[model samples]
Target: MSLIRKATILRPILYLLVVCSCYGDGGGRILVFPEDGSHWINMKVILQELHARGHDLTVLRSVESWYVPQNSPLYTSVTVNPAPSSEEEDLGPDFFSDLMQRSLALRKMFPLRRFLEQQKDTMAMLLTFHGGALRVISAILDDAVLVNQLRDSRFDLMLTDPAFSAGVLLAQYLHLPMVYNVRWINAGEAHMTIAPTPPSYVPMYNSQLSDRMDILQRTENFLRYVTIYVQERLVIVPIYADLLRRHFPPGADLVSMQRSADMWLMRVDFVLEFPRPTMPNVVYVGGFQCRPAGPLPDELEAFMQSSGEHGVVVMSLGTLVSALPKEVTEAVAKAFALLPQKVVWRFLGERPAFLGNNTLLMDWLPQNDLLGHPKTRAFVAHGGTNGLYEAVYHGVPVLGLPLIFDQFDNVLRLQVRGASRVLEAGTLTTENFLEAIEDVLSNPSYRDSMQKLSRLHRDTPLAPLDSATFWIEYVIRHGGASHLRTNAYDLPWYSYYSLDVVVLLLTPCVALLWVFIFVCSRLCCSRLRRKAKQD
Candidate 1:
């Protein structure tokens, strides 16, 4: 072999050796307790990256999980049979669609009435969901053999999605250092639990109000903020009471356990989320799952080319929601028909009678690939965090049909930024939907705003995924990130708020004021007596 050829052949081998030496013989052992469905999608991305980096990952999944599979090439799967009834299984496929329909119905009522009813319904749903989750964890804990095996495994850390408290509780029980892949905790947005969220500016989840709030809006925000705590205390905390009492220390509670995480990999960016106070332990890795688009399939590419001058519009309501209500879908179909742009929709339900020939309906489409297509004009979405971030990443303007949960708030953020238009599914009509579509298509500003946002989101020191991986590896290298965490979680509520300190500081001043008042009154009485004597 020639000298140049031998050197070239040796180059890659030397590089591989260098990389392997940097990571050591074998990577850190990581245990992942993930939430099911869409949350799993996000977790899976991180797991894949971690696996690629030479980490040994073990994923704990429920037998009835819809998304977290029992078999995977990335990680060793540990499937736990919680009970005869599983939370994931109990929430049948139609759960989200049904919830969306109920939410739409509530939207038609008086605003106050709607808020009250919605709160009631939401609380009931949360209780049921969390209750089922507790059961699953309880089952796992009860399995002494399984618990012992997990303990003996000597896992470096527990990485979890704290959407449900199961992983939090389990991590605490196993005494593992935890890193949370979290956006929402059990009560509400993760920030509400760990940061100082002043109601004056930081809007509450589901308020659908922006950071800039007037007095009335601030009042609403404050009330909603109080309501979240109330729900957490009364509704959510009790669901985990038994598990905590049995498995944890006397003072340990769900919120405190959640806050005790070593690091929070917040799946949000300030470009997409309203700016708020954050903790040292919290790291924003928003759009970690997003990447530059790859080539589309031959058939899909042909469709894109066929759009010609008009371009194509892509729509997807996320994974959980396969379709909207019949009336809403029909109206949407009619609107898509009116648009000159070709439509590609990710629809799973029966075909809408009004669906035009211009529209292509598929059970699934490569969402990221389609959004990145050169001929892609605009996106119609349900305002999921993943999808919204993907849209921002791709710089595609949106027409939002927000359904439930954080969808309303997610779309509102984009609308506030002038990157998207929002519509209510309850009041959707063919004319309004088409008008909204036309407005987005015709207006140059929406695309401009979104493209600007894309530039900002992309203009980061490191890719969000790489940042997340580094932090995860950082946690592993150090055993835990305790130094980054705050001692605030250790303080009692009164001490945390400084209520006791306020009382102590005020007590001396209050006593001094009383003494002064008494002396002044006595002097005045003496003067009055002397005046009477003189008279």
Candidate 2:
């Protein structure tokens, strides 16, 4: 070949080589601290994106993920599998459900006064269970072989959810910078970490109150805040601290270390959640799990198409809620039978006997895809954050059956915004459940409101996944990018909010007023004495 021809062939090859090299060449090793399979789903999408971007990703996950399906790519792809011991297996996949069930029972059986008193017992039990879980998780993460692998891995950062203290323990053990990916929309937890909005406008998690609260609601929110604060700091954090101390070295200060995470990837946004001020290190990645609906499976497509013009309703209580109580299941079945809309209920155990001809019961579902379908009109859900966001992303109105944790609050806010109706588990009846579905379906306003909110959620400058990946990479590139952390983390609560300044300003004014009044009284007494002498 001539020299010019050879150069032309070499140029094409060079271009191809450069393109391939640049595709995902961020070249950072990131460790994802494994969690329960269900909550891990929240991190899966973003982590996959990070992985595709050429970051070396490894997950330390449970060997037996009961909640994670065998076929799930995310679970199957896990690099390090921590096998569950007999005791750990006994804890069961429904451990979270069992906790939520207790909270639900507390909400139902007692009045506010009685509930507050009893909450201590519930909290104590939760602390015990959480402590046990942490020990097991720590054992897995701190396995001699695993520890050696981690130590030799040269990982840049550890990304995890701090719901369990194990992630923090692993990070501390390996001495990697920690970043948090929170799944729950717990406002109190956020306040402790980054933002410190007043309870007057910022409702407590699971309070079921709006941001703009009445005096009664505000008082309740404040009380709830106090309860959560005390429970987390005095009970939960102490338990976690103790657990860490057993395996790790002293002087770890686990709570402080948790608070000082380089970044927090919160599964919340102002569109669904009420507006609140946030610190620079806190990033909202709500609707990050949302994506364009792909082609549905044949059976699911047929089920949805059966509804025709009336459209379909999607009912799911998330992965945590494997099955409802028999009575509630029957109630839902009866309610769905009466609706013109076809119902696709995600029921894992035995199918309810009363399940209507119009309804389809499946053990698993492609929930986001179903919600995005044009035929999907309304969602009857347990008000879990992911399901709620998917509904919002698709502009589908909802009939909320809020069970526990932040579900009550999530549904209440949707109700406040006129996008849904909540049938509290305590007050739920078949008639009420049916009526709620009808109300959401018949009402045009609910759909309209949801559509408006959907627009806002989808109108982000960057897709939620991309935004999350960018921030994750940013942290790696700048070595934690700790400059983004606000000084509020370092300041005491009173100093951070300047309550002392308000107290100082008020103190001098009150002192001056007291002195002025005393002088006037003395002058009056002297004038009276002079008048008497003259007389």
TM-score of each: 0.93, 0.83
334-393 in candidate 2: lDDT tens per residue? Answer: 888988989888888877788889998888889999999999999989888888888998
- The all-Cα superposition gives candidate 2 an RMSD in Å to the true structure of 6.9
> At residue 454, what lDDT does model 1 achieve?
99
Q: Determine the backbone clash count of candidate 1.
A: 0
Model 1 lDDT, full chain set: 0.90
Q: Given candidate 2, what's the lDDT at residue 73?
A: 44
Q: Point out the worst 10-residue segment of candidate 1 by lDDT.
A: 82-91
Residue 269 C-alpha lDDT in model 1: 98
Residue 76 miss distance in model 2 (angstroms): 9.5
